[model samples]
Target: MKQPNAAKQHKPLWTKAFLLTSLSNLLLFFSFQMLIPTIPTHISQLGGDDAQVGLVIGLFTISSLLTRPFAGKALDSLGRKHVLLVGLSICALTIAGYSYMAAITLILAARFVHGIGWGMSTTSLGTVIADIIPAERRGEGMGYYGLSNTFALALAPLTGLWLMNAYGFLRVLQLSTCLALLSLLSSLFITYPKPPMPFEKPAQRPTLADRLFERSALLPSILLLCTAVCYGGIVTFITLFGREAGISNVGWFFLCNASMVLIVRPITGLLFDRKGPEWVLLPGAFFTIAGLLLLSYAHSEANLAAAALCYGVGFGSLQPALQAWTIARAAPNRRGAASGTFFSANDLGIGLGAMALGALATYCGSYAVMYRYSVLLMVVFLLIYGWCLWQAKRVVRLFGRTSN
Candidate 1:
């Protein structure tokens, strides 16, 4: 009799909290994605040089990176619901301000504010969802939760590009503001338990050392950084690479990539739960390596699409696998810090990769050459992932002998 009620106490993966947070995440990502490609064009329009474009795009991520540790502290101290709503509202304000800006300095300024909001919102949302999900089912739930961003990743850029051509930058940003507002409203509907305190009450105020990052999450976060740098190459230069390779239309590449991601995400998460991270991450690395190599020499639309498929499958699977593992291994009360650590790694990887690979592309004489070089990072990821697996096996063997 108690068993059934015990089950009832555990929320379904698709609880109101999950749905609202996911929808809010979708809206937030949609608004961000809608502006991503257009921002560079806008920078160019403002008479900024290429280096300035890099600064404009890169600074947003820098701000996000800088804010994540503080956001994590806030999420742990404040309620998840409180942090989430405030973050969304901040994002909404920053986006609205973008609609009224034209100068490069103002645009860069808005991006900085938007990054703070973005960092806070994403960190809180990940922590909140980690709260709702049962430990056993975290991988599955996070996989589904990531779909909202996947949908946005698939659709937003096309819409943004279309809108820019048809309605102009101001109009597109106005629409972006509307989407962010919708995110805030959705966040308002979420009801979640306050995040529990991480440890016994301290005798004094927590120090700066105590305020940032979760040590338990650091391993997977570091591993993710390697793969994420590889991803930066694709996100930053895939379109230009396609053009360089004589493929005029690259929209289908993302559509196809999103399709594979949708198909494999749930499956990979299920695999992670049953078999552990090694099985999922190792093969995923190989897929990524193969994809990058193929992308280097792609000529036909078909080869390009194949690269998208392989890379998408690899990234889609490994990303949530890392996220679930990061939070799952964290102390129960420290999910917020775990999430912050995870995303900070993401921001760090993407920002560094974008700049490093951008320079690498210039030195190598083409984006194609740069992607081929990016494979070397994925190779390092494989080595690190292998070490993680070895460590996992050693622990399992140690436990087995102890039990015996």
Candidate 2:
């Protein structure tokens, strides 16, 4: 790894840059999230079936996934502030465009554009936080930075649903655009870290390898894909899933879910920094497995909320823990690449999961049955995670014995 930037200095956690950037993250996420539930409903309103709904939802993720590799390179080469503002501008325009789109094809097209904005903005935000935070405190800092989104999560679902109910899809799209604009305005105030000077003379042209992906972060990114697959199922269908059980509002579940995430996010980050991934992830794996199992059987508000609490705690802790691991292992100069790689894997899994789960729901004739498959995926993830850990230990022991 390159030597840590000599300029990195100890600063208080809540600097103006961090605060403003966090606010920007919060607002951007709110705008993006407000459409999550509403969009599927809107697709249905436009005469799209569940399969078509999945296609529209999944396309956004596919678009973002395709762009993340390029966005990562841009974060490193272009100024963070510039990339950020451009992303916000795109988000503002694309969100407003949704209001004008009546056909399913048009909505899908708009979602694709919107995903590009989402991919760039989120990648930059994570990289910006990494640039500013102290290395020793990165786990904690990432967890705290994530709080902006998690806190926003607490409100976005209910508010989005409420807007849809009160003002309809068109107005929801309009209000979502306003939120994106606010995110852009807040980003304008964020202090961009001084751009790092490249250690070597610039190449005339970069190769495909450098532009494509970050190698050091691949392990964590792949692992995250496993978890994100299950998360996608929840994000894409939980509203309709709840309605399947006679509950019209999914706010309570998200409320409980976000609350648990809010509570554990910082603590798990601290634990990851202090005690390492083994301790933090073991419990997380258990929580995730149990949560999915519970969710598959949810039939009442109480049961649904209980499932949310479990999933939230698991997901909340694991995401930052894994992200810290990704960035921690990466060379400082390539953190933007790491962030991009991580989020790309994240979006890929979500997109595929939504599509696959939706198809399964269609074949099986209900979302509840599809969730049973999500539970199985979670279990498989834990098994894979455990096997990888065991293999790592075996490799370490053999290397030690050889050196001896």
Candidate 3:
């Protein structure tokens, strides 16, 4: 028999879509991170306490989690570009609303609305990428895509703080709003490949398993969720915790963390592409566990720097690995659903962790207590990650046996 022609293999339209979508995500996340370091301070300015700040941030995750399934369905039925435009428009409007809202409740409501838009947009983008990139290259592609957001993380917060100090909060808000609008403009340039048509009969919808999982999906999704809980706690409260510990310029911590992620993410992505997730994930988890533990006892600026380096390396490496793994396991037609499932798990973990950490902080009367608690949570996550690694090895062995 003639060998199949490898020359006929061509880069698909989906790859182009992923590139544009990644750019859009980068701009959108840049706008978001610009606001991250300032949100708590804004809440306080509007007469909200730490508990209220927690609610405001936690509610955004809740809104996103609640709408993710619907967004997935919409991606299947409505097409990616249509869903994306609607989401970006709404996100821009809600963010503008946030700029003007003075009441904590109104601000929370605006954030919740923004979260809905975020859920829809990001879900559609991931699905669009899945439709474009090849399965074997998914990990590498996803890692490249993730770097866009990582770039935003590295720069946005520090810029925001500088603007806040140099000018005023209103000026910072204006800059943020401009970035959101820029994302909207960039998104208009993104084109999606033809989406799978909607099911003719709503009742004939595929089961969740048929939509989200086929082979290695479950393990990666679970791992991402666990990591998200760790992420949520740190991003939401790290500044406050640092301030409480007498660390001035807490924005520097975010700066350092994001910078490290931007630097390390590409190298890790290459590693994932070559050696596979098993090699990257175990060490990633250990780094994260160490970071959280160090953060628990951190007081001096030097300790904070150490913790940021550890977190940047660990969580930064793991996120792209998990995302790529989840997409790699799903059928081509079901990539949107798989993305939805992954993001939903992520949203839930972050939401729950923020709420719990907030409550703990309220009772304990110190942010250090929250960090200590997070260390304990990381321990649990480490144990679970170990079990997942064992299971993944067994699955590989079984597959090898069957192939023989």
Candidate 4:
């Protein structure tokens, strides 16, 4: 009896399904992250300006925003494997198309379609992970899973840039397409868990609101959105900003960021599991704020690496913790919707940040100033999160009084 109880207590988190899923996610992110910094550079090489670059990122995110809600519903209703396959196919095809197109308009069109694939694939993968991971060890499992993204971040940008510099943008695009194909292939082998409540029939079909979003997941989504705005700014413009600051190799920043994230993720995950999000989020936010502030002034590679380290810890810690929070707050049956809501919010934030901050950079004529301005969003995040905590405490106290 004691052995059985201990075995149940230690239910495996790293099952074959989880490993395959993580591998799929890693490869997908490698494809995605490899393109992120290089795309803006590609546009520049094609005689496109900064605004065009912004439009490219914005359009991709907007299309993703449009697709994620529907994808979430499909994950719940249609099942995970089919939705994942469809999404991966779309991603693979669209990514391959980039190498053939020279016109900005064609690339933009492709980007819109690519966003749909990204929305579906990411939402399905996240939902599947939530389904498979044990409830008790969700934070830890998510942390480990997110290491894929961290590793991708560590290697993808540098690899992409190197390929682009050595051979050409065509080579970079070719490699990215290959990576996407590999990710798609890897996903085909995963054994997905059945959706919760498969046998239960509802009295009424779900409304659009019910299909699109989960109310329970909103707080964490909102919190995630704030940080994502800042993230969007970084992802879209950091390479150009590196040039503006006269740094020869901006790739090192990603390397440093990923390195720090690799170190911080496990520790933060353990802390989140043992203590709570508050223990991680508050300090994480501070670190992010400091990192951004430091980045605003970074002129040397060392300074850039320092900024990345701080930002990495903050961003890395906050993301998984928020994801875990979203999953924990949601009903098992609604996990798909919750994942969609969370990712949709993330896309929206990134879109907004890319568009708005890109314009701001244009207006100010300085990337450094733009980064400094982006720090305000993080400040807003901290304020809103703190207010939520205070409100929660007040509600608890009121409940105590009512009980008396």
C-alpha lDDT score of every prediction, in listed order: 0.85, 0.83, 0.75, 0.89
TM-score of each: 0.93, 0.87, 0.84, 0.90
Best by TM-score: 1
Candidate 2's displacement at residue 5, Å, is 17
lDDT of 3 at 166: 88
Backbone clash count, each prediction separately: 0, 0, 1, 0
- Candidate 2: residue 161 Cα off by (Å): 2.5
Ranked by TM-score, the better of candidates 1 and 2 is 1
* Residue pairs with backbone atoms closer than 3 Å in model 2 (clashes): none
Stretches > 4 Å off in candidate 4: 1-5, 40-53, 102-104, 198-206, 243-248, 362-366, 398-404
TM-score-best of 2 and 3: 2
Quote the lDDT for 81 in model 3: 80
RMSD over all Cα atoms, model 4: 3.1
Candidate 3 per-residue C-alpha lDDT over 175-255 given as tens digits, one digit per residue, 9 for 90 to 100 = 877877887787787666787654454477768655443344556667777788778778778878877888876666676
Off by over 4 Å in 2: 1-11, 43-52, 100-105, 197-207, 239-250, 361-369, 391-404
Q: Give the best candidate by lDDT.
A: 4
The global Cα lDDT (0 to 1) of model 2 is: 0.83
Q: Compared with the true structure, what per-residue lDDT tens digits does model 2 show for residues 320-386?
A: 9888888888777787888999999888888767778889999998988888877777677677778
Q: Indicate the residue-level lDDT of 21 in model 3.
A: 78
